[model samples]
Every structure is written in C-alpha cells, then in structure tokens.
Target: MFQRGPGVPTVEVGALSADAYLLDVREHDEWEAGHAPAAVHLPLSELIARLDEVPADREVHVICKVGGRSAQAVQFLNAQGRDTVNVAGGMLAWAAAGLPMQAAPGTEPFVA
Candidate 1:
C-alpha cells in the first residue's frame, strides 16, 4: 500500500478555499453527481496521460468518491516527484462535513 510522509498536512473542506489545487480522481459519472467547488476533474483512468495538467508549484489534493483511488493517485504523483496529498475519507467525508458541491457541466449524474 502507498503511504504519505510523516506529518503531511491535510485540508478539511471548511478550511479549503482557492489556495490549492483540488484533483478529483473519481470516474466521470461519480464526479458529475457532486464534487467540491473549483475541483479539477482528472478521472483516474486519464491521470497518467494528463499529468501536465497539474501544476507542480502548488499543492495538489487528490480526492475520490471514498479514498482508495485518491490514495493511489497520491502514490503515483509522489513517485513522480510531485507534491500531492490524499483527501482522507474523500468526497463522502466532504459531504458529511456539509461542504458545498457544484454540478459539472455536460456530465451525467451517477445513480450510486
């Protein structure tokens, strides 16, 4: 399994603003259902091919529906020398925390 460095900081939804980059690793449909405001969608399936989309200078927070995929993403990005953090508990936790979500245009909602 992948692991982050000791004492890596994680931002809660309430504390997140526009300072860092939010990378959503969920599938297309899941992302369309709901996601953090200003989050950039880069489905796990396409991450490897689209790494250039992420800016290296800023903090990147990886998120998925729960947490698994985001963990994987963090591992991959870290291996590539990119600074990334996994959003523990993922979007589910974000919703539980009552964070705001926006519908991604042109995408269909996921039933599950």
Candidate 2:
C-alpha cells in the first residue's frame, strides 16, 4: 500500500525491529484492546500535554488504528525535532504481519 501522508517517513511491519520503540497514538480503549507489546501508550488527543513522556534519545515509531493519527504524530514529533517514523498502515498491518501484541488480561489481542 501507498504511504499515508506527504513527507511522512515510514517503515513497514516487516522492517520493524522487535525492540524498536513504538508509540501507540490511539485512545485508551483501543490500546487496551490490543497494541504492540513493546509500545508506549500516548493518545494523540493527549499528546501535547504528555509530550515529555516520549523518549528523546531514540527514534520513535508511531502507529494508530490506521495510519492517519500516527502520521500526524510523526509530523508533529519531527517538527519538534524528534526522529520519528510512521508505521505504514498502522495496527491493521501490524496484526496482518503477525506482530506480537498485548491486551487486557483474559482478552483476545486485536486492533480496536
């Protein structure tokens, strides 16, 4: 599939390292529903206030339910001088690629 936003740096699921720093920009429920096991939770809606939580020493890999919000986050983060990349197709592709995920206890892992 084509990249989601103009000038948005991107990486596909296949190229992602299991140890890569991942940022999930979806809402809490969506994150609880399922997300990359190593991902950091920071909703796009709360991003500005919680910007400090983002790690400054590493390249941030961002994702959303789809590519939209994460693309926006990448743009914002890059503008703020954080090296970041959008996960092309976001969680949809993440799940399709069989990437590891974590969810609430006793619940199935899935993209919400």
Candidate 3:
C-alpha cells in the first residue's frame, strides 16, 4: 500500500494493544459491515469538521478498507499538527491479523 505519509509513522496490527484508539476513516456502510470495536468512526469526509472528536493529546492510528485512505488521512492530520499514524495495511490486514472486531448480527465480518 502507500508508504506511511511523508513524515507519519505506521504500526503493524500486531504491535497495537487493545488500548490503542483506532480511527476508522471508511464510510458509514463500510463501518457498519465491520470495524474494530474500539475504533472511533469518523468518515474522512467528515474528519475536518469533526476534529474535536479526536483526542488532541493522543496519537490517532488511522485505518480504512485498505491503506490508501488512511495514509492520506495521516498526511492531512499531520499537516494539521495532530499526532497521528497510519495503521499500515488497514482493516484488511487488521482482520487477517485476527484483531478484535464488531460486525452486525448475522453478518460475516469482512472489509467493506
């Protein structure tokens, strides 16, 4: 996928703890399909307007169906002076890595 944003860092799914606050930047439908139970949902389209929802003091680890969107987001957030990083490989990798997720009842978990 895209290399981490210009100066932004990345962390593998395995390296993160449940305590990490994952920022899922996918759309509403994608998020509804499945997402990390602990992740904060803020579609990229709304990120700028919802900046206050993200913790300024914490390092936000962003993700999407794949790495592209999240990498783009990392660049934007960094430019805004927010501490953020791309979760390399994104949700696809996160699922393959066997991370915890919450899907709609009766729905099979998959990156949307």
Candidate 4:
C-alpha cells in the first residue's frame, strides 16, 4: 500500500512517538469509519482552505487509507514549508501493526 517516491519524506508507524501529531487526510466517511485515536481530521478535499489548522511548530505525520493521498498531502505541505512526513503504508499498515484506532461511538473500529 506504500511506495517509495523520489522526494517526499516517509516513516513507518512504529517510528512515531506515543503522542506524535497525526493528521488524517482521508475523506469524511473514511475518517468516521475508523481512524487513529489521536489523529486530527483534515480531509484532503478541504486541505487548502484549512491550511492553518495544520501546525508549523511540530512535525506533522500525515496519513490516509493507504499512502497515495498522504503522499500528495505531504508533498503539498512540504512545498508550503511545513514539517510533514507521510505515514508509510498508511492506516492499513497501522491496523496491521496493531496500533490503536477508533470509530464513532456506535461503531466498531476498523480501517476504512
């Protein structure tokens, strides 16, 4: 689900700190279905308009269902001079790695 591109930075889920700043760039349904417990929601569709919601002081870990959309978000965030890294293998790998995830209160957690 992940790919190595020429320039955008990437990191595995294991490398992240327990409290790392995670940004979920998936669509609304994808996010609501399941997401990292600590992630901040900012769908790629609304990224540009919500740029200020992303942080500049701390490194941002961007993720999506797989890696495609996150790679795109990382590229854009990097170009705009933000410290961002694509979460390699995205949430699929995250789930496979047995990391914690959450869904809406009435739903069970799973990768969307």
On TM-score, the candidate that comes out on top is: 4
Ranking of predictions according to TM-score: 4, 2, 3, 1
Model 2: per-residue Cα lDDT over 39-112, one tens digit each:
88999989888888988899999999888999999988887889999999999999998878989999999999
Q: Write the per-residue lDDT of candidate 1 for residues 8-63, one digit (tens) a residue.
A: 44556556656668999888888778888778999988988988987788779988
Backbone clash pairs for candidate 3 read none
TM per candidate comes to 0.80, 0.93, 0.89, 0.93
Better of 1 and 3 by lDDT: 3
Clash-forming residue pairs, model 4: none
Q: Which stretches of candidate 3 lie over 4 Å from their true place?
A: 1-5
Model 4, span 1-112: residue lDDT tens: 2334678899999999998999999998999899998999999989898899999999999999999999989988887889999999999999999998999889998888
lDDT of 2: 0.90
lDDT for position 93 in model 4: 96
Query: Per-residue CA lDDT of candidate 3, range 1-112, in tens?
Result: 2234466588888888778888999999999899999888999989888878877898889999888888888888887888988898899999998887888889876788
> lDDT (CA) for every model shown?
0.78, 0.90, 0.85, 0.91
Clashes of 3: 0
3 versus 4: better TM-score goes to: 4
Root-mean-square deviation of Cα positions for candidate 3 versus the true structure, in angstroms: 2.9
By TM-score, the better pick of 1 and 3 is 3
Return the top candidate by lDDT: 4
Candidate 1, number of clashes: 0
